[model samples]
Target: MRIVAAFLLLTVFAGLAIFLTFTSSWGSLLIPQAAANEAAVAVEEPTPMPDWEGKFVVETNQPVVLRTDPFVAAQAAGLLRKGEKVALKGCDVSGLWCQTEAGEWFVSYMVGTLPEGLPVLEGVKVQAAPTVAPLVPTADPAALMPTATPAAASVLLMLPTPTPAPTVLPQAIVADAANLRAGPGTSYAIVGSANFGESLSLAGRTDNGEWFQTDGGAWIAGFLLSDPPAGLPVVEPPAE
Candidate 1:
């Protein structure tokens, strides 16, 4: 009878050990899977960009090549300007480049060249503006008077009208690596950036040497219209 009792006790102990081993192994495997799933859920999503399109400037001195097509091996058709506005189509996140409407692709450094006064397209489509005519002065002083005024009142307009300030537009450049800023001084904020071998427009300037024009839909300053920096190449725009 005692042998029978010992055998039954040994059988019960063996069954308990097998159950514990299986339970521990299953728990270990499940815990890691649960932790992995939690980690995946904690990750954040990427932000989306606007659907509108416009231009960007080159902020570096390095020569950036733009091909007739987006592929690298495509024939080199044209060059870009520093602070020059090119039509942007969309952003390519995987490639880290902006694809221009003209099918040109450029990196971020090339797009930061202009900061302030850059024209923006927003969601609205706009036609390119007509060139502004130069303001010319007339010799007849009396002709400057308002026509709606009485003859006696017109004579009182003797106060010489201040000469209209010259309407200077920003000039464009076809070089690589231009600068853009809020003001003419280097201390001013670097509101824009650019890449190498880019062309740009010089709209106007201040006496302090600050340049102002549209860069990527905003106004920025850095380069001037006077002279191209030494070692930089300049390309003329195709004839209209």
Candidate 2:
């Protein structure tokens, strides 16, 4: 009888211990799991630039000149204030002149430190000089006539090729939707894209006239554009 009584007492104690273990707050078990799940999800924030301005600008007290082309010989397109904001399209390989979204070129420098890399073009020329006409000698009209001497007869006359007149403004209509490439040929990689019927300003053309460079320094096939304005300065093709 004593042995049975002891066994019953032990069994009652074991049951009580189990009941105490499980009866604590039910939320204690689920709360940690929910907290762990929330911790696993991460929220990212954008990195902040302390000195970054929304747009690029020249660091000077005077107004900055905007040119029609990248070269110094190009006429002034307009002017921008020293603190005026200007958007950048891209820069030439040399990174000297940066093209603006407005299709004009400007010198690339800022008041703040320059970013690690400027958007330098891979296949582009910094300057494109136009062919100049031969100068006429300042002499009498009779002196200009060819003489009977053998040396005078042998001198080859160089005639200047007339640049064709553009029927329209220095712009073109896109015939089809396509990307503007980096080079003159179709094999080149695309730098930007053009939509069908979109009008783009023309900067220049390849020497053979097979490619046309838009004002933004991107190249487009000559055939893709609708009758690009003539007399454009022949630009140098990108290296192979």
Candidate 3:
């Protein structure tokens, strides 16, 4: 009986020794050198980007390649799908390239910007506007005004035009039921609506004249209206 009990005690000690040998520093000797070295190293963190300047959405129909640099020839870091929202750092004044918070760049035209109803950017490279001829011959604007006599000037100061004709802005009718968007394009958020035949007070137009900006700072497509009065003031689209 004493010899059997000693054998059981020896088995228990041997098992414990085997477990400790595998679980302790001694186990490293049996491990592959490369894996052991990798386990010893800490992962390096990525460098941080600057605070976001604004947010934008991917506007392209296909996946847009995120370039390492602003140029199209730059190495591609990754891809962004259409309509993917991204927070940007900033864009160049020329509006060619925009950088993201992830340290990647995308082409300016491939991203959603101001609404579609807004006029095309003047200097920015966008869809090429068809060439429009000069509607009227250029003349000295100052020479066109009639020279007022002293008596007429005095009367004008006393009683400005009895009507608000001077204050009245250019107006357009909603020939078709169209949406009034916050920006110039259909891609912009809809803020209001113009019923059929509703009259809209016009404030400005985009450079390409494809959109008309309302007095309330909303945008509607130029094609959505009847003939707009000539000499509508050309204005820039509001930043979204």
Backbone-clash count (model 1): 50
Error of 3 at 225 (Å): 0.3
lDDT of 1 by residue, 84-115 (tens): 55555555433334456676654434455433
RMSD of each: 16.5, 17.3, 17.5
TM-score, candidate number 3: 0.34
Q: lDDT for each of the candidates?
A: 0.48, 0.65, 0.65
TM-scores of all candidate predictions against the true structure: 0.24, 0.31, 0.34
Among these predictions, the greatest TM-score belongs to 3
**Any residue pairs clashing in model 3, and if so which?**
115-185, 116-184, 116-185, 117-184, 117-185, 118-184, 118-185
Show model 1 residue runs off by greater than 4 Å: 44-47, 50-240
Off by over 4 Å in 2: 1-169
Local lDDT at 57 for model 1: 32
Q: Residue 138, candidate 2: how far off, in angstroms?
A: 23
